[model samples]
Target: MRRTAAALGATIMLSACAWSNAGLPASADETTEDARDSDVILNMFQWSWTSVAEECGSTIGPAGFGYVQVSPPQEEIQGTEWWTSYQPVSYQIEGKMGTREEFAEMVQKCDEAGVGVIADAVINHTTGADTGAGTGTAGSSYALDDFPGIYGPEHFNDCREDISDYTDRDNVQNCRLSSLQDLATGSEEVQDTLAAYMNDLLDMGVEGFRIDAAKHMPAEDLAAIKSKLSDPDVYWVQEVIGAAGEPIQPSEYTGTGDVHEFDYGRQLKSAFGGSIAGLDSIAEGKLDSEDAGVFVDNHDTERNGETLNYKDGDTYTLANDFMLAYDYGRPSVYTGYTFEDFDAGAPGSTATEVGDASCGAEEWTCTQRLPEIQGMVAFHNAVAGTEVTDWWDDGDNNIAFGRGEKGFAALNNTEGEVTNTYRSSLPAGTYCNMAAGTDCTETVTVAEDGSFEAVVPAKGAVAIDVEHME
Candidate 1:
């Protein structure tokens, strides 16, 4: 299975579902096992460019996540608003977060610690709402019909400004989204510029890209630009929001890289909220397989309330734990600081320096860094390449299951604790419990009968491993 940095969402359930051309490789090869190792791909999302390196050190960095999904790295338009990063001034790596050199240093340091970096590439459009003569550090000019010749008007969709016509493929695919200036990606100049920008990052050591607003761009044009990138190791993940079924959908981008599986997040949250049944049901497993990327919340949907966010409270933890426990899409964990309004950015009111500038040590939820959270990473790594087997559930929200023979976990979100005995697949021994707070405050023991008794707390989850067992 190829590791990806893709979009996942809730609103996507409203659209028709689509499937990926490729599936998990039939047999687990060395590459498959390595990729499946949660210790390698356990990821966290960071706002500023250097936040990953500054906050998460080699300790959690190497043992858990291999990389980070950083906020957009390109030059963004200046505004008091936080959405400015969505508005690209140019393709230059320089931005409010950091300069090109600083970004290079950050990526190198993270790489030294055995963690990779995935940049959020926002190439769907340009800075101005229309377009105007503005120069990026790389000397790229912006021209639009609203302005003139800075970036030619022909570069735009030149159709209706408002794109309410979802039926019109051109308006949906080519036209500007959210009043952002649409770039004619098919143009040779534009393709070369994008390639140049990406190549710069490749030279600086970025391993992959999360193509922003991918659903809005012409797949062929995006493909051509991707083809020009220098690194074949550079993975591509397009943000094709909503369901798949349009003439231009996620499938178009799959041959190049994985597209976001938006429906998974919605279903996950619904399941955790008790609106849907637990994971063991064949119905629920089938529901999660529609796409490759699985996540509880992302930058956009977190603001929209259509998806689960940190502010949603403990509910997010339950859903996230379930996602890790169950086999599904490549999980993208959201790691951010506290926020008040829907439109908040990082931990700061203004976009200034990178690293610890935006959010302080107090606010950041370095998700994978937490012991309970890191336990999930360890569980995933221990059970790498194992299919979930020996599924057991009472059908009343309390459940227990094992992944192959490597690990077993249980969850009880009910009002009272659960003291049930079930087959633990794992060897007889004691293992540390993750959901029981830091330093493995709780423990689980498996007997020679392979039956373990777990007293699951109300509204909590527990995980145990064979290796950790005595």
Candidate 2:
């Protein structure tokens, strides 16, 4: 039997169905687990099924990641562009990523490694009406609103035009997005088909789903579809990019599952670009930490330049390090191929088939596998359930803080090493500096007085946890 742990869980159910990006409000007498109590997620975007299985056993599982969010596995359009995977033709678990049998085996391998798989479920719409007739990665034929043995024009929406008005709920929810045939999600036939497709993946041992383009579909319709799942309580996170003054927002769907907190990344981008001191209030105006799935940069944001990405080099590393150390929403580290063009495909891949992840290859930037990043994962797991305390920042580029008595971290984003005596909540002991790479050669000592003096290197970070001592 497969062992599964959810990276997404909503303890509070909303009383009012209001559409606000603000998260679930806790009751006066309500008590909930610390937002950071859950484990971290590694979004291995575009990684093949076989490659993901190998990575789970080799790196991800050992690093203590609770889950790995994979790209869409259903049969998708046959194109070299990465977005092609987002355009589905059928519900079969056969595509460039792998065959149905291979996907099952990958799930088993990851389960054995204690890593749960969260599949990217692209159920909002199918092949774009403009793509004409073509074959999918698994040889399924699709054209316009026609998917043989799956869906047809009757299953799609009557709103044939593209979405333009955001404030208008009807237009935003019903209209076609980029000419992709929108599913009649409210209809019984479409809902059943979508549920069956998701149930298929769940039966194969996927612990959750990252509902793609969730904002395009009405929250009520999505909730209905989720109710029909084999395990309605299965972990899921919706990709609802929060936009100001938008009628449909992330909060509207928290009753169903967690929603990605876009503000978290945007704030990280701004703070890293300016001063780390500004990050003190990172969660002030966003979703409550527990109901949010936060990331430094995902596939879309990396291309659209909405947040700091792997290209930002040291800055990106420092930002992610801060995210891991901070007590906030569940964190997910993203890794993928390096590309200069927006529509470029993954490395070692083609229009017909996808490639596997090779860590050291110049084309693939396995950011999650970096020594510093991997060490931070251990630091994150060690400090789980702790609160941020002893916060201190230089008003400019340097900051240091502790997570209760479990861990301490200091980061310097400036060009020169910054030395400072920072207060800590950790007990008196020498601990390994987490950001010191794989060897963990550097150590920091927390004195009986609960204070530590250290020199944080420029454009770098240093972290120490009780579980990882020198």
Candidate 3:
């Protein structure tokens, strides 16, 4: 999702009353009620509204996943490319995912199923193409920087150009990202428009938002816009990619909301790739657990080959298992369609509409359906807020840990199975290995003295939580 810059010589144009209410709720506690208690969020990338609704009723809700981050729901540029969803044609709740009616229905059903919907918002830019005329998926017509009644050329940045330098803060914030038209967020009209769009979603029962390309906008401008939002409690997780020497850092955006921990995925990739012993260092990262939304990989990282995706087979699953079991950040699990071409859209469908998702068919990898992963989700929920204790490592590829008497996990990354006896925090009892679900024959018996013997299979994990105790 990195964007290259071109030039920036224009000053941000703003109206006299651009700043609205300045004292906005900036704490995580101010987020939606569902998000406040959630431990994990599932990123169902590119899944249609109906598909997400079905999964919520069938799998995610029942499995205890807190929320599901759906694809951009707004009307977007008509194209078969996946990135087309990132190019907003209008704020209308109509796009390849489904119609506004269908989206509303999906939200209602998901809410009934005890699952919250977090919309992926593409407010940083509109259509990047210079084509003068086109129709969006929702039948909205547009020409150049004009989005009919929603936005005009004046609402966009005067630069009218792509970002030129990543090292410069002004260029990164003001310039267009990969030719995408940059919005003048400092303008009261732009802030009011974006706030209206977001508030509409909130009014329709949306729980939160994942602000796409948040780093491309100035932090104070983002804060001002957020302040104008009607739902002050809506959860916000910004996509702020920070690296060494980059002037725009994630810390700058933390005041707005939690930022994605990109380094978490990078470190997980390195740990799961060969150095499992290094997993212990994850808690020592610069970002605090309370301020990060962590995941092993995202749609962009998977496409860029920066992090391990479902294509890595068991190794990828193991990484997810570790993320769910470890207590650090609010974990997110990602599942999407697999494709040979990075630019290819989801399976089945055309430029105007996306068909229903057929999980496990035509390169669609529904990793969330895996029993092991589902059990891990339960493990995370069962041990929520519990401190990680009883950390033990074989000083190699084998590791074991307990979560304040609520859960225990042992993972072996080596090529061979490893068995070891360790002290458990759980009360003396027989527990089913959640990794195998209720049908699992393997069970761990903890002694009264809080000791148990575990045999972790090669490249596999054994997880047992209090809820699954037999």
Candidate 4:
């Protein structure tokens, strides 16, 4: 580990210092209790100004999602294109998404609903376009060759013609991403400017940030900007996608916050399709142990045809059911309106002037509001502290497991009907059949032998507990 810099407190800029978690004593029982008590899973996949503000307070607020991940709130070059949001014109909060006041209202509303707001910080670069829309950016005008007094030519690396290899650490960290304008994060001026923009959002009651293009920035520099901000709860979940064996590792950002777990999506895709045994695989430690952020899909992967997002009907529900039933690193649910093209903006899409209600104009509800969805949420909350106790799998498609004594879940992916007998950890009583979708409620009566026989559908899953049992 690198020695702690003496000038760490001197300026708010990043210093080349490494954080070591070695010999940091284990957490106490009470501390774990407090952590479990306060932590709340969120579904903040949508990112427009009005949609974010309204959903932050109302839509996902009451669902007990602890955080709201808003879209990039910074001003971008004016264009009808959706990717324009990713191409930042300036650090200013005003954009087509919504105005500064609307952003504040969203944050306060989420806070009031016991949820935190996370801003998407795009400090990695600027608008890569040459002309026709680059104007009035953070009170400065910009051109292809002459970006006014605010940004200097030295602040940008002229790697336009000479593209650097992303496999190399320096090139990935220092060079431009996909011909986008690369900002010189190592420069003192750039650090201060970016830090001020982030701090402004923090002052508006935003809790943390999702550092976009985090893999393209150095950890030391990110730490420097993080040190400048004065919020104890300022969480950072960087977007560093990783597979089974990748050079660009997720462990690099474990000290910062949680890294996005791309493997989780792969696991869900495989397990739900019956390629991998559901409960047994999860029980036998197929999933990574370290706390990597888990999600079915996100904005980029969903659009790129890489991972399975929740735009579909029953397929999405099965995926989410497994996620809620099994324990994984901090879980995040995605809520979005159906889109015809990948580059399209969010539903009920409106510019910053119209406000959040516009998003609802295109809002479409699928399995997210299903009765089983609510049941899974309650089950996840109920078995928060427990670990997988009794595991059972037929080795092919049928599987079942219990989360200590709190709850039990089973899955059947076989073609025809198959009965499975498993130990019912819950006390003798009638339990609710969660997967039956309210049309038919099957009763699971726990026998004195401490076991229950569940006859599931031709191909389906089931979750039962003492509370909602008929």
| Top lDDT prediction, candidate number | 2
What are the lDDT figures for the candidates, one per model? Answer: 0.63, 0.81, 0.81, 0.62
lDDT of 4 by residue, 353-426 (tens): 22243443555443344666656666666666567768777777777778777788887666666676779678
Q: Rank the candidates by lDDT, best first.
A: 2, 3, 1, 4
Q: Which clashing pairs does model 3 show?
A: 5-163, 5-164, 6-163, 6-164
Instruction: Give per-model TM-scores.
Output: 0.84, 0.91, 0.92, 0.81
Residue pair clashes in candidate 4: 14-224, 50-356, 98-352, 431-469, 432-469
The residue-by-residue lDDT of candidate 2 on 102-173, one tens digit each, is: 899998898788788889999889988888898877676778877776777899989999988988988988
Give lDDT tens digits, candidate 3, residues 1-470. 11111100011121112312112123322333324245578999999999999998998888888788999988888988999999988877778999888899998888888788889999888888565578888777777777766678898888877788999988988888988889999998888778877777776778778999999999998899888776554578999998899998988888867899899998888888877876777968557777888899999999998899988888898889999888887788999998889999988769988888977585788888888888888888788768789898877788888999899988888878888887878999888887755455779898999888888877888888888877
- Candidate 1: segments with Cα more than 4 A from true spot: 1-46, 128-151, 244-247, 281-291, 351-362
Candidate 2: count of backbone clashes, pairs at least 3 residues apart or interchain: 0
